[model samples]
Target: MIQSIQYSLDVIQDEARQLVQKGVVSRQQPIYVLCNYIPAREWGWVESELEKSDFLLRDRIGDLISHENWEND
Candidate 1:
């Protein structure tokens, strides 16, 4: 579970940096501009901005499942 969250955070940060670099997001503003107000969900969206990006998220999740995944499952 910890691993999953860590990977997701990593991908989100990577994507956020990319967005800032591309001018899609402003450095002075919060990441919520490109993503929703919710950091995790918005970060997840960032992970899926492109095709096969979903796989990027899934790869990070690995075999660790969490309460959130269970409730949604």
Candidate 2:
């Protein structure tokens, strides 16, 4: 039982770390950052870029990955 618990915790921690890293990358290089040099009215391009970026997709995929690992743990 203790072995199982420890293995589960270790898996969960590793999965969580992956999620955190993905989140940090999404936030740090977000499309919004590109709007800093553009005019306010040009934010649409930045918004569009952000919408198509892997940020949301990565987050959702990461969630699934983490969930799978946690559930088995």
Candidate 3:
């Protein structure tokens, strides 16, 4: 489950950064704006899991929220 969340976050961040780099959006914008572009099917479970335990997730990831591949990166 954690792996799935990490994967979704990675893709979301990558696409978000690309959009920012292209001037399509600003880095200061909320990430939820770019989330619509991500596949809902793949992210649905992750979103549910996050909602179920938002605090636990935050504790698990800590300050690595913006880091890609939390296990290795």
Candidate 4:
């Protein structure tokens, strides 16, 4: 049986924000760039979550993030 993965918009948004804060990805990149960090097998779940939320793969990370926040290093 195939395992079902659950993804929430808030989770995806928070994840993208974290990735940007950690320098794993930049805000200028497309949302699809996130797939590189997520396992290939799980991208379908993430993609569907994004789609359900009206997010497009071509949407920039900066656009997808609800807000931009930076921590002092």
Candidate 5:
């Protein structure tokens, strides 16, 4: 059986960063798009965390992530 992983704000950010690294998602994309990338079973947890963190579906992925190398030079 697959163990369920909890999706906290930190985990969401980490996963977003990796997605950015993998070019699967860009920081400018809407947060809603993440549902397409994340497994359906876990997306609910992630979405809830985002909502609690004051994030909207239309919010940019960058809003969830912190300052990193992606910053404009």
Candidate 6:
């Protein structure tokens, strides 16, 4: 058997808003700070924070590195 669940836009939006308010999803400033100012020694801590905020830092960094390599080659 297969099951499917559907959510209404208002429900989805409300859930997303709650996540943002709870720090489970982050705003742009935090992401920018992580990108620009995170120290090497604090990478693990920063990565943990990003994970908690539902950011796929490892996968995103991998993609960015690949793109940069491709651009240079």
Winning model by TM-score: 5
| Per-residue lDDT of model 4, residues 1-73, tens digit only | 9876676777778889999999999999999999988778888889998888778999999988864345899
lDDT by residue for model 2 (1-73), tens: 2221222323433544554465642333333333344456645543443344423423443442344322454
Q: Please list the residue runs of candidate 3 whose C-alpha ends up more than 4 Å from where it truly belongs after superposition.
A: 1-7, 39-73
TM-scores for the candidates? 0.38, 0.27, 0.44, 0.79, 0.80, 0.32
lDDT of each: 0.43, 0.39, 0.49, 0.85, 0.84, 0.41
Candidate 5 Cα misplacement greater than 4 A, ranges: 67-73
Ranking by TM-score: 5, 4, 3, 1, 6, 2
The whole-model C-alpha lDDT of candidate 4 against the native structure comes to 0.85
lDDT of 5 at 40: 93
List the lowest-lDDT window of 10 residues for candidate 5.
Answer: 64-73
What is the alpha-carbon RMSD of candidate 6 to the true structure? Answer: 14.0
Expressed as tens digits, the lDDT of each residue in 1-73 for candidate 5 is: 9877779888888888899889999999988888887899998899888888788989998877873334577
Ordered list by lDDT, greatest first: 4, 5, 3, 1, 6, 2
Candidate 2 error regions (>4 Å): 1-31, 56-73
Clashes of each: 0, 0, 0, 0, 0, 0
User: What is residue 62's positional error in candidate 3, in angstroms?
Assistant: 17
- lDDT top scorer: 4
Q: What is the TM-score of candidate 6?
A: 0.32
| Residues 1-73 of candidate 6: C-alpha lDDT, one tens digit per residue | 5433333323333443454566654443223333343345545655554455455644433222222212455
Q: Quickly count the clashes in candidate 3.
A: 0
